[model samples]
Target: MKGLYCRADAADAQPKFVIQETSLPEVLGSHQVRVQVKACGLSPLDFKVPKSVVDGCYQFKLSDKKIENRIAYWCEYKYEWLSVCLYVRPKPEKLSSVCVAAALRDALCAYTALHTHARMAVGHTLLVMDGASSFGLMCIQLASYHGVRVLTTSHSLQKHTFLEQLRPSVARVIQVYNGSSDLLPIVLEETGGLGVDIIIDSGVRLQEEEELKETKCLPHKHELISALGVGGHWVTSHQDLQLDPPDCRLLHLKSASVSFLNPETWTASSAQQGRYLHILKDILEKMAAGVLRPQPEDAVSLYEATVAMETVQHNQRKKAVVQL
Candidate 1:
C-alpha cells in the first residue's frame, strides 16, 4: 500500500511528510477491509500538530504496524477509510472513483460529538459559541437536519457571509455573529432571553477569557457562561470540566450541565466505533441528497500529496484531498 508519512529526522527539525510504499495485510479480518485508496482528506491539524498527538486515530486503529500521522481520509477503524470505502454504498464506479464519497466521511467527528455528548432535540436552539470552527460548522448543519434551530458565532466578519452561504437551506440558521467575544448577550436576546438549549465551544470552554486578562474580558466570559439556558447543555473540548465559581453557580441555579468532549476519543469504545460507521454512511447519503455540504476537494495525485497537505496547513479550512 502507498501512504504519506511524517518523517522527523532530527529532534530539532520540524517533521515533513513524504510519500512511501507501505506493506499491508492481504486477508480481510472479517471486520477489516482495505479501501482502495481513493480520496484522502487533509485537515489543518495534519500539518499544525505533531504526529504523536494523532497516532491513535489511524496508526493504532487501522494498521498493526506503526504509521505516521495521516488519518480522516488523508486516510483508520478503530480508522476505516482504507481503499474499501470506495463503494461502501451504491454508486457508479466512475463517479465513486472520485474522492467525493470519501471526503464526506470527514464530517463524522463533528456529527458524532454533538449527538453523543449534547442533549439536543428537535425545535431546540443551540448557540455554537465557536461557529467558525469545523466542528461548529458541521454541528449547525446536522442540527438543522433534526429540525433544530442553530445560531452560530464567528469572530471573522468574512466568515459570517461564508457560513450563511455554506449553510444548507433546510438548516434553520438563525444567526451568524461577527465577533467571538461579546456574543452571549446577543445570543440570549436572539433566543428571547430563554438562552439556547445547547452551547458548543469548539476549543476549551471560555478560551478567550484566558487570552485577554483585563476587566473587559471578564464580561465576555461571563456572558458566554450566562448564555447557557436554564438547564441547557454546554459541551466543549477541555481537559477540565470545572468552571469558575460564578459560572458554576449560574449553571447550578439554572440546572444546566457541562461536559467535555474530544474528537480524538471518538473511537474509544466499541459502541462509539459502531456509531461512527453508521454516521459515515448517513453523511454520504446526505451528500447525495444535497442536504449536507461536501468539502470542496482540491484533489491531488500521489506526487502532489504534499501540496494538498500544505494547502490545509497554510490556509485554514479549505479542503484538500489526495486521490490514489
Candidate 2:
C-alpha cells in the first residue's frame, strides 16, 4: 500500500507526516472493507493518523452495514438533506467516503458534530465562526440544507465571494474583525437576543491571550451573554483547542458546553465514530442527488502525494483529493 504515512522518528516526540510507500495490515477486521482508492480526501487527519490511513473515506462502506449502492437505492434518507452544525477537517467522501465523498469528509464531521453531538433540529440556529474556510464552508451548507438558520462569520473579505458558493441564506453572513469580541454584538443581534443554538469554530482568527482573557468567550458576566443561547453547544476544531480553550466557568452559567474534535481519543466501538459513519451513509444519497453541493476539490496524483500533502498543509480553500 503506497499512501501518506505519519510516524515520529523519535519515540518521545510528536508524530509528523511524510509520504512514502507503506503496507496495510494483512489481517483485516470483519467490519472493514478494502477500497479501490479511486480518490481519497486529503485532510489534517491524514497526517495525524500515525499510519498510512488516508481519508480514503471516499467511496467506501462498512462490510456489515446495509448501505445500498446508489444504483441499488437501498435504505437512504428521503429528506432533501441532512444538516450538521460543527467543526473541521473534511472526512473522506461517500461511496468512497465523500463518506463519491472531496469535501464530503469534512461534511461528515460537521454532520456528526451537528446531528450526533449538538442534536441539531430544523429550527436550530448554528453560528459557524469561520464561514469561509473549507471546514466552515461544509458546515454552512449542511446547516442550510437541513433548514437551520446559519449565522456564519467571515473576517476575510476576499473569501466572502467564495463563501457565498456555499449558499448561506441572505443577510446571515456576519463579518467579525476583532475575534470573539467583534462576534459578541453580531450573534446577539442576529438570533433576536436568543443567541445561537450551536457554534462551530473552524480555526478562525483567534485572539491573543490577553484579548481572550478580556473577551472571555461569551463572558459569564458581560454584555455578550446573549451570544450563546442557554444550554448551547460549541464544537471547536482540535487544532484550535491547543490555542484557545473556551471559558468553562462562563459556559457553566448557561449550562453550555465546549467540545473538541479528536476522533483519536474515541474507541472504534464508541458510538461517536459509529455515529459519524451512520451520518456518512445517510448523506451519501444527498451527495449523489446533488442536494449537498460538493465543495471544490483539488485532485492530485497519489504518486505525487508528497507534493499533494504540501498543498494540503497550507490549503486555504478546496478540499485536497488524492486520486490513486
Candidate 3:
C-alpha cells in the first residue's frame, strides 16, 4: 500500500518523511485490527513512525472483534488503507469523518488532562494556558460544558479576542506578552487571591536561563506553583520536565499535585486498552450530543498531505486532516 513513510539511514539520524509506497505486514498481531482509510489527522506523531499509527477516522475492514463496517477512530493512510493495532468504536452519525478525525485525539488529551489527571469538578476555576491551541480549545470547551469556570491565556490580541468570544464565554482571557510576569497576578486577581483550582499548561519553563519565547508560551514553573490554589492539580504535557527541591517544597506546602499528561499509556499498557476504548466512546457521544465541539481545522486532499504535514510538524498548524 502507498502511504507516508519516514526514511532514515541510521537509527540516530533525523527521520525524513516522504510520501511513497510502503507495505504492511501480511500477518496481523493477535490484538490488531485492519482499518480502511477514510481520513487521517495530521499531528507531530504522524511525522515520526511508531509501532502503530492510531490517530484518524477509518472504517474497520477486518478484526477478530467483529467490528466491520463500523466507522471508528484513529489510523494513518495515504492513497490506500493501513492497519492499526488498536481497537475501535463506532463513529458518531451526526458528524462527518473528517470532523470526527480532527476532534477525537485532542478531545481525548483534554479529557485525560482535566478529568483523569486533574480531577476537575464543577464550580472549580481552571487556568488553561495557550487557549488558542487545539488542545487548549478542547480543554476550555470541556471544562465550560462541565460548569467549571475557565480563565485562559493568549499571546496575541487576536487569540485573546477569540477566547473571549467563545460561545460559552471564558471567565477571563489574559493577554500575555513575551517576558511578562503578568499571568500570575491576573490569575490571582480573578480568583480573589486564591489562585485557580486547576492549572493546565502545554509546557512549563523549568530553568532561570530559559528565554521567553513566543512560540511555545511555556509558563514558568514557579508561576504555575504559585498560581495553584490549595489542593489544586497541575496537568502538564512537558515530558522531560524536571523539578528542583524548591519546586517540590512549594507544591507540598500548598498540597498541590503535578501529573504528566501522557495519552500513550492507554495504548502502551495492556490493562488500559479497555478504558481507552471507553474514553473514545464517551468522546464521540459527547460530540454527538453537542457537549463537545471539534476544533477549527484545515482539510487537505490526500496528495497534499505530504506538504501539509510540515505545517503540523513545525507547530504551524494544530489541526490539519488529510481527507482520502
**lDDT against true structure, model 1:** 0.57
lDDT of 3 by residue, 115-215 (tens): 88998988899999998888888899899988999999987778877887884659888877555668989999999999898999978887756775543
At residue 77, what lDDT does model 3 achieve?
A: 33
Models 1 onward score TM values of: 0.68, 0.67, 0.84
What residue runs in model 1 are displaced by over 4 Å at the alpha carbon?
8-14, 23-34, 44-106, 129-134, 164-181, 204-221, 238-242, 307-319
Give the 10-residue window scoring lowest on summed lDDT in candidate 2.
70-79
Backbone clash total for model 2 is 24
| C-alpha lDDT (0 to 100) for residue 252 of candidate 2 | 76
Sort the candidates on TM-score, descending order.
3, 1, 2
Better of 1 and 3 by TM-score: 3
Best by TM-score: 3
